[model samples]
Structure formats: structure tokens, C-alpha cells
Target: MKNVIFAGVGGQGVILASKILMEVAMNAGYDVKESEVHGMAQRGGSVDCNVRYGEKVYSPLIPREEADFIVSLEMLEVLRKLDYLAPAGKLIVNREKVDPAPVQTGAMKYPSDIEEWVGKNVKNAVFVDTEAILKELGTRKALNIVMLGILSKDLEFTGEQWEAAIRSLVKEKFLDMNLKAFTMGREYKETA
Candidate 1:
């Protein structure tokens, strides 16, 4: 079975990214299951999705420490979901920081040592600057797709399959930009 966790704040397209992955897995003939938590998403609160696919999937929720991949669209969300990742799982994280309610309200501080912590704790992690990539792509709305592109590198899906999935899910107006973002993310080389 393949377990993937997609996490981020609201408006980051975390759900859309998971949907694209589900589409890809389903298109490849795998039985896919998914679960989502949209806690205060409209208020920029946390959002996460669990996706599992294989020859047979009986559950939508990924058990603790069993996820093969944790694709986080925000750096802090990586910390929040780190416990779900398998010991040898890969982390594909966008290097963007979105402050939570407490942090925004000055009740708590966002951890400043995320990179250092990840360096010590995560065996395999790829950190991408989705902001820079999106800036170059001329669209800020495709961060999720870019993160998906980075994740596509480790999955078994072909480029064409990914593109097809993106084409199916993304609207026509944003297709070319999102496609470019995916290519850039797939080709991104920086790692942690």
C-alpha cells in the first residue's frame, strides 16, 4: 500500500493536490481511499488530507507512522504532521511559513528552527521554494501543484499521467501555468 499525507493551511490547495494524486492512482487502477480534515480552513486554519492506494485499500485514514510520504505545503505543517510519517518515508515540503492563530495572535511563536529540526530528524526531505518557483511561473495559486510535482518524482506515475491528471482537475485558464509549475517542481534539485 502507498500512504501519502498532504498538509497545509487554507487556500493553499492541499485538498486539490490530494485529489490530483487520487485521480492519478485511480487512473492507474489502484483502489484509493481518502480522508480530510478541514479545521477552520476558511479562516486559514489547518487542513490535511490522507490518501492511500494499493491493490486493495480498506481504510481512508492512514495509521500513525505508516505514511510513505508526507507532502506538506507549509513548513510548520510539516512539524505538525511529522509523527505520521514512516521512519523511512520521504518528506516533500514547501519552504513557506504560514503562522497559525496563536502565532498570529502572539500567544505563541512559530518555531524558528524548522530546518535544523528537519535536518536532524528526517532521513529524507526535499525542501522547495514554491514561492520563487511560482513567481517565476507568474502565478501564486499553483503552490499545491508545484508541491505535487516534487512529489511526482518519487511516485511511480509517468509525466504524462501526472499531466493528464492535472489537466482533468485544473481549469483551462490556469492549465499552462500549473503545468509549468509542475515541471519546475519535478525538476527542482534542492534537498535536505
Candidate 2:
């Protein structure tokens, strides 16, 4: 894989998601490098992370037009970063929208037609309602894990390897839920 782009609004665990993938890749013995832009970033602003891994990776930066996987934690941001996605890239977007608090509070702004925009721009889009899936799993906070579940399908690691990777990253307490989420995500590819 040349590059992977993880995009979403702030507080959506985009960075954590990338970290998990990075760890998994590294655990699989691949040279991995990741870059993230997160500072005073808030709920409404755009946040993204770049992860590049292979036998040899030179830079942590992922240039526009090189991303092979566009994994979106939020639907709109998928459109926000669409231009950076490679021509034949695959998109995995959470099929729900967490409109920024600004739009909800009438204190900020929001772009229009985000979902439709993404559809028009991306030819290969896989829509997964992460929020709903997590709720089905009996919690709303598991949104990130649920989305990660979808991403598992794209990884080149084995189930055992992925579990080990998750164990290496998550706290012992969050192990069960996270593992469940990851397994669900990893299975998404086989059945998708």
C-alpha cells in the first residue's frame, strides 16, 4: 500500500485509529511511519492522519493523489479530503453524520450536500453506519472501534496478529470491546 488517509472531524478518534493501524502494520514486521495534524483542533475543524508502511518507507507525509485508502470517520470529511484520494482508491465512510456543534448551536457553519458530494466524487464507496452498529453492540462510544471493524477488512494481517496488535495498543480494560470491534471490522472484508 502506498498511502492511507484517515479523515474526520475532531474528537472522532481518527488519530487513534491510525495509530492502531500503524501498530498492526509494525507488528506484522513492516516499516511504518505515520503523521498527524492535531493541535487546537476542535469538533468542527478537519483532522486527518497519514500512514505509510511497506518494506521501506521514506517520509511520513502522504501527498495528495497518492492515498490508496480513504477511511472516513465522518461522511462529510470524506468529501473534504476527496481530492487527496488516488484515482482508483477505495473509500470506507461511516454512513452517519455528526454535524459540527456549530451547526447544531447556530454558532458556526457547515458545508452542503456532503453525502451526495462524496457519492459523486468517489466511485468506489463503502457506506457503513458505524454509530448504528455500535449501538447494536450496546454502546455509542464504540463508534471508532466499529468503524475500525470495517477497516480490518482491508488490512493484510491475520486475526491473531490483529488481536495481538490491539492488545499492544489498548489498555487491558478496553481489550474486550476493542477486540470485538476489531474482529467485526476484520471480518467486514470477507463478507462485504
Candidate 3:
């Protein structure tokens, strides 16, 4: 079974990404279960979705230290969800930083060297500058699809399945942009 934890702040399309993943997996003939947490999400708060797939998935919840992949759209969320990554798991993180309310208000401080920390701790952590990519694509809303594109590299599903899922789930107006984002994400290269 593959346990994937998608993490990000509100408005980052974390849920949408998980849905695409679930849809793609189902299309690929895997039994899938998913769970989501949207703690104060409307106000730029944290959001996460747990997805598990295999021959048979019994639960939507992913236990601590049991996730095969933790795909995070924000750097800080990656740090927060690190414990969910199992041994030899891969951590895919976006290099964008979104300061929380506390940090914005000066009541708390954002940690420095987050990428360094993750790199030093996780053996296979892939970091990408998703926001920059989205900006270049002319749509920040496609960030989630871009992330799904990155995650797709490690999965067994074909590009057609992913594109089909995206086409089915995304609205008609935004389909082209999202498709572009997904393609860009697939072509994205990870740097050391």
C-alpha cells in the first residue's frame, strides 16, 4: 500500500491534489481511501489530506511514521508533517514560504534553514519552487496540479490517466491552465 500525506496552507489546492491522486489511482485499479483536515483553512491556516491506495485500503487515516510520501506545498507544512513520513519515505516539498498569523503578527518566528533541515533528515526529499513555476505558467491556482505532476513521477499511473482525472475534476474554464501546470510540474527538475 502507498500512504501519501498532502500538506499545505489554505488555498494551496492541497485537497484538490489529493482528489486527483485518488482519482488517478482508482482509474489505475487501486482501492483507495482518503481523509482530510482543514484546520482554520479559510484564513490561510493549515490543511492536509491523507490518501492510501493498494489492493485493499481499509482506512483513510495514515498512522504516525507510516506514510510513503509526504507531498507538501509549503515549506513549514513539510516540517510540521515530517513525523508522518515512514522510513525510506520520500518528502516532496515546495520551496515557497507562507508565514502564519503568529509569525506575521510577530508573536512567533518562522524557522530558518527549513530546506537544509529536511535535506539533512530525509534521505530522499525533493524540493521544488512551485510558486515560481505557477507564476511562469500565468496561474497560481494551478499549484495543486503542478504538485500532483511532481508526485506522478514516482507513481505507476500513466500520463493519460492523470490528465483524464484532471480533465474530469477541473472546471472547463481552468482546464487548459491546469493541464499546462501539470505538464510543467512533470517537466520540473529537482536541484541539489
State the lDDT of candidate 3 residue by residue for 132-170, as single tens digits.
887798877888889888988888888899899999999
Clashing pairs in 1: none
Off by over 4 Å in 1: 39-42
lDDT of 2: 0.77
Which lDDT tens digits does candidate 2 get at residues 1-192?
558888887777778788888888888889999988767775468888999999999889888888988888877788777777888888888766777766799896677666676677677777775554575567665667667767776667777776777788888888888888766665554222
Clashing residue pairs in candidate 3 are none
Which is better, 2 or 3, measured by lDDT? Answer: 3
Positional deviation of residue 18's Cα in model 2 after best superposition, in angstroms: 1.2
> Any runs in candidate 2 off by more than 4 Å, and if so which?
42-44, 105-112, 189-192
Q: Tally clashes: model 3.
A: 0
- TM-scores of the candidates in the order shown: 0.95, 0.87, 0.95
lDDT of each: 0.89, 0.77, 0.89
The RMSD (Cα, Å) of candidate 2 is 2.5
Tell how far residue 6 is off in model 2, in angstroms: 1.2
